[model samples]
Target chain A: MSTDLPEWLLARQEPFQHGDGIAGGKSIRRGFVEKSVDSMSLVFRESFFAERLASRPGLLQGIDPRVKVLTTILLIIVAGLARHPTTLLALNLWILWVAKVSRVPLPMYLKRVWLAAPLFTGIIVFPSIFNVVYPGDPLLILINFSRHFRLGPWTVPETLAVTYQGVWGALVLILRVGASVSLAVLLALTTRWQVLLKALNMVFVPQVFIVMLEMSCRYIYLFLQTTSEMFVARRSRTVSRTSTQEQRCFVSGSIGALWNKAYILSGEIHAAMVSRGYTGTPKTLVSFQISRLDWLWSLFVLAVSLFFLGGDRIVAW
Target chain B: MHIPDGYLSPQTCAVMGAVMLPVWAAAAKKVNNVQKTKYAPLMAIGAAFTFVIMMFNIPVPDGTTAHAVGGGLLAIVLGPWAACISITIALAVQALLFGDGGILAFGANTFNMALLLPFSAYYTYRLIAGNSEAASSRRWLGGLAGGYIGVNLAALAAAVEFGLQPVLFHAADGAALYCPYPLSMAVPAMALAHLSIAGPVEGVITALAIRYLQERNAGILSVEASSSPLEGHSYKKLMRGLGMLILLSPLGLLAKGTAWGEWAAGEIEAKMGFIPGGMSSLAERWQAPLPDYGLPGFEHNLLQSSTVYIVSAIIGLGIIFAITYIFSLVQKKTTPDKT
Candidate 1:
């Protein structure tokens, strides 16, 4: 039966190695590889696309980007200031709930939140190792490692042990990052980029910025499409092509060409914009109303955030 | 560089906002002054280009990467005040639309990258290129120096913004929280890294683009000439302008040396005493309270102290220039030729 499986199926069956060894043997095969692939397939399905295509109809969607902007700002502040693990965890759970209520897909939420993993690893894990190895805190000695080496006479005694505090700190950092990223992703997913820009403009965001963003967003897609076509053309021209370096060169050349094209296109776009009476400012059709729902939502979120913050303060006190 | 909200004290953000408002107003006023109907399209296009280019990150060695915000390049082409307004707009849009930076930090970010960098680069370019013929080599060199200073100035501004978080805000322990990393260490490290990284990226792009534009459409350069007397000059005159270049190089070195000296002095003072003044006392008074600078361990290290100082000086210097320019606008009627 195994021999009858196709080469691609065999390749897909290969065991995956995780950095932390947190996953069990069966879980790695079932959870990571199979489940993730299934999740990705679901993400790209017609139904999924259709759902996304359907205009956002929630209270959050209609609120001005400016108000959303304010909410985002408040959320980030509340999350960052929540020092205790319990509070941070509560905030994370609340964010997850909000994401669920807002109809954000689970896989999409997980993928975006996963970006925080690397940051957590770099800033928390890497630094925590150094902290644990040092002998100042007894808590550091309890968690990470067992080695200890004394420096010269003047220096404070150092140990190479990971402690409880170091582990706790790393966990806290991860939680913080997870919460922040979740909030940001939620905002990005819920809010349309154009509406956000308009809302920003209303809130005293400079006109130059709005116009720049509009042009760049428009041009970037065109640039990408043009470059992809160029890439295909280059691939067809090349004989006996398979070298990574050659592929890189071809891509880079396409990029250089794309840059020139973009420059020229900018001029054309500028002329077109001028002909259409573009007067150094971007025009948007979407008008923001700070509806009662927006106010209620903001207050509810604020109340939840305050609860976490207040709880953290009380616990620490 | 994007100091998230709550990372900074409310007071510090307010101070930065107060300092930035008039500079922005002045930039707006300057834009109003140059509001020729023909120039409007070009300005919009230029603004668009700024946003597009910044999205393309040039890799740097220090784990962080940067891209050309083109504030200096824009200032050279569109004059400082107009550049400020345009760059400010670009930054604001980036924050809101793309999440490239935090919205709350918008004031500091704009003041640092837009107002300070461009104006500084313009003055530096004027000093180097002078009122002479624009040689390709001289132009490249001026662009290189302008770019180098401009990026470092921006980085310094970033460090200061980070450092001031601890200074203006009180930690849970009631101690003044400032950036844990000293400016000396952080500044040199950042400046040196960016000097090799974003500096070259900006220089090459600015020079090549400027040259291409000059060759293909000299009209754009001509438009800039009205606002900037330095543009469209002969290469011979700019070469003769080498005197200022020679003088400024040594002056830059002296300034760097003095900055290093101050940092060294601070370190020596900290070492002579066991406690490092502000945060340490706060830590002592409030047991297990979060360190003023968020970093948990390694609080008293020399590396951290030096970084704080270097970063602060960069921010302080940029702030000084921004403040000076705002004041210059107030005195603009008297100094009509300065722009």
Candidate 2:
């Protein structure tokens, strides 16, 4: 083959592609493959960092995982049932206190739980502040749609304004989510993945589900690695601009291929398991021991939750 | 779509949770019977696949991306019960491990995504596909409808949950608790999102994946295929066969004489040299409804006779279907239920 490209081919300005390495753009757009890889890596990193924290000589790390899981769940439930912001604030402080004593970095812990909570729950509750939404005392007048008119079925008030009650409600919602996430993230931060799964198994999740959960966790990494390779290979070979339609096709085909691999792999895994004297029902030899410390931890969490709950009710009454 | 903690009131959450308990139990029972413990490994793999599948970010029209839940696709391949279990386990892992969904809202999420999605998809696909061949376009269409309807219904359920918040729970001070959006606002916003984006994405992905599988490994699409009692032939093949028989019916007009053994007593004597006593005697003994496949007073002319023949043929086909249905019912009764 001739080394020199035709002049016509070189001169031809193709309807330019951007973001897939070859195309000119201000920034590289991370396609689905890269996005998926990043997500998978995040999972691995979370688990890895969690393992390190869980192994440390921290307050929660010393307790039984089963106990910690239950307490965490109870705390979240308490946060959900809390009507008063005082109870919610108390829960947040306790979460921070627990994180500090557990040897988890307060800043990082706060960021992980707090940052995402406000962004997600804030957007949801923000619109609640409008006068037409909750109909309370106005805090800030937003926009007036001139005369009060019906936008289809909903009536757009003449003066759209933010309400004090709406803001308070938003604050309560954000706090509730933060407290719940803080407790949830704390449980994860201070517990090993294996121990967590076993804890869940002991907590009456079906054995079959436990087995599946165990296997799925193992396989996610495998598939993620495969996906990374597929994307990397495509990047390596791209000499020209490919259309978005073609990229979409590749993505769909990738899904089909991934599913095919998973489906076939499952059968092979099953057969191999059967050959090794495996039955559908899986039995594990692991056992969890809850000590006095675990019981004490559980009781402490319960007492604090009850105290705040009662105090909130008294305050409300 | 994953309704996080604090979005739903505890009472509302508990009520949704309670509703899902029976559904989960029924799904578990169904899966256990259909797939013995040996199916555990596959289920685990399926669960893992579901977890990962949702993470896929498909780039869409407006320089954006969307993720498919993959519940409908799972329902098509694994059957609704198994898919339900698989998605439930996947959701559990996400909640407990990653905190992607709330632990308290697990049942509610399962109710919407796991129970409603797969069950609705499975039945819709089943209704559409019927006993059509695995490779048929009808199956693909069914897959599309299943996925489209499945995601929309789940979205609607979640929307209803969000909408009910302000209505169901409020503070003594007149502050709205939980979600502030009423049913009117929540439903339309959710309907627009799911109906516009999620519905088509799910439908296309499911349909294309099925088509790909049909071209690649048609053997694994055997869950529904194996249960069909149409012998080895599909309904498409049955229809073709019936059409073939209809087309060949004109060949009867080319015959010179009465069909063999279909002759009257006089004709039998004239053509067969002799009439056997048993056949001649018993031929008159068998009385029948719609004798000679003719409607009385409808065979006076060619047009009338053709009408009679067409009507009789339809009646015959209906009778065959009825017999097959009765036989299937009998077979179902005779067989012991796995439970």
Candidate 3:
């Protein structure tokens, strides 16, 4: 079986990919070998998952999912209301500390949150460079190579200008995006998916939506696993065949297949749910209980926020 | 895209809130009506679908990533009211749970993306497709066109909202409102980019989703088809009347353009026929007050006055009439068929 595996697949299967090293790999090898190991790893290390682990957690995790959801929303409102970079940075750092105390792995958190950097940077870059509203001194200029012309006497050049204000604006945007993304990630990681759904339901996040999310998440994994197996089987049968378009088509077809499977699976799942006496509401054996620690944490966060607001007022004055 | 508190002047935010409140209330009330209740589940599903799809961003040439808002698709699948409610809820969730948009700007954001774009697209689709039994191909075409127009309109709306901040708020540095790269440039650039790219992405996604649901569980989209009847004489006549209104409304305002210009010229001549340095003096007087528009400078000369007024009027009237006609048609059709 090992000999039949492709070099690329084998290389990706290394223990370090799991971030647990060789020893940890050996311990889990028995169970891991039976499952679609690649998918399991991919699912575990998805960027969003990592981001969630990096965010802050709280008493909401200990309380009913619904209560936790309300708090999460309240927290987001507080974060969104912050305008200053200092406030955002301070909030981000506090959330980071919370994640740290909660024992989320640093590497996973970084890996996930880092994916947003390029996209966020792009949004700010253009606005900063050609900012018509707040034009500052030009930092750089790029002349267009293709579009060169002469006007009567003097030569005319096509150029794009980048300004200092643009750079500053870009930095501010990055900080804002970082703050928001971090907050969101923290919520996802600290709370279980089910709890989060329950919390949403509690907050009047329409029941139909909650149900859709639950079903989608549940079936997504199954779809991915089945598709991965099908892809592997196809690859094994069609060796030495490679084309980007073909590959895309194959993946899309596989997605279509997964959609069909999901359609059928829903009916089966619904039947099974009915048999188990499942109603619209989900049942959890574990009840949430908030301790003194939750109250202390909440107050601390509030105080920190207040301090930032006070500082903002002082600065404005 | 979310503007935080303190970015816009308090006055601007308040005005946006005032406009948003009534529309939101109306949407909620419409959603509550028994006839619209059948669409509730589909709306919920559509919202969830939008949330998930937006997460998968496609990179653009400028290194920026763009995602389809799915507003047009929702409007096409469900009626405008249902789409408005679903998109509003989705935007709310994203802001609250994901921090994707700002809280203070939620009302503004909802108004622009949820209410304006989808309604615009739905109307456009109705115009292009006409009053006929909408074939599967036409539905797909409508979905594509609507999605494209909806996303671009939303982006434009956001740009205008941002641009108006300084003027509406009386901010210290008014330069932001009338800069070399004013809201006009920013709004179009953003709108065009999304119009070209994200529009197609949304169109395809919408088409695929509709096709999927239609094939497997036609019941899922039954509310949409039933409520938004594609065939009706009253609706067609109403749309045609709207189109006529849009084309003619500008005439009412601009009809006296020549007279106004003549009157202004006569006044200026009566005061002093080509007074030496008269323009310079007038410029000096107005420069401080209207630094961007009123400033007595070469910058004002660079802009064509008639062109700006005419274009703005046409665009504004066009949008207003288009949306009005579309909503009226949809309401008329959906009323009797309400399950």
Q: Pick the candidate with the highest TM-score.
A: 2
What are the runs in model 2 whose C-alpha is more than 4 Å off? A1-27, A142-152, B227-339
Task: After superposing candidate 1 on the true structure, give the runs of residues whose Cα lies further than 4 Å from its correct spot.
Answer: A1-59, A62-66, A116-121, A128-138, A142-178, A206-216, A219-286, A289-291, B1-18, B38-43, B57-71, B166-185, B211-219, B229-339
For candidate 2, what is the DockQ? 0.19
Candidate 1: residue A46 Cα off by (Å): 18
Q: What TM-score does chain B get in every candidate?
A: 0.60, 0.66, 0.58
TM-scores for every predicted model: 0.62, 0.78, 0.57
Cα RMSD for predicted model 2: 27.8
Tell me which residue pairs clash in candidate 3. Answer: A52-A185, A55-A186, A65-A199, A66-A199, A128-A166, A132-B181
Question: What count of clashes does model 3 give?
Answer: 6
CAPRI-style class, candidate 2: incorrect
Query: Which TM-score value belongs to model 1?
Result: 0.62
Model 3, B146-257: lDDT tens digits are 7777777777867776665433322122222111234655677767767677666666555555555545555544445565543445445645664664465334423322
The number of clashing residue pairs in model 2 is 1
Q: Name the top DockQ candidate.
A: 2
**Tens-digit lDDT string for candidate 3 (A73-145):** 4555455444445555555665665455445665766655545543654453446455333555556775544
lDDT winner among the candidates?
2
Which residue pairs overlap in candidate 2's backbone? Answer: A280-B37
lDDT of 1 by residue, B208-316 (tens): 5555554545455434556652333442453355345434433332231222333433454665655456755665577544333224564578687546534543453
Task: Please write out the lDDT profile of model 2 over residues A56-147, one tens digit for every residue.
Answer: 66667767788888888888888888887766876687667667766788877877888887688998788888888778888898887789
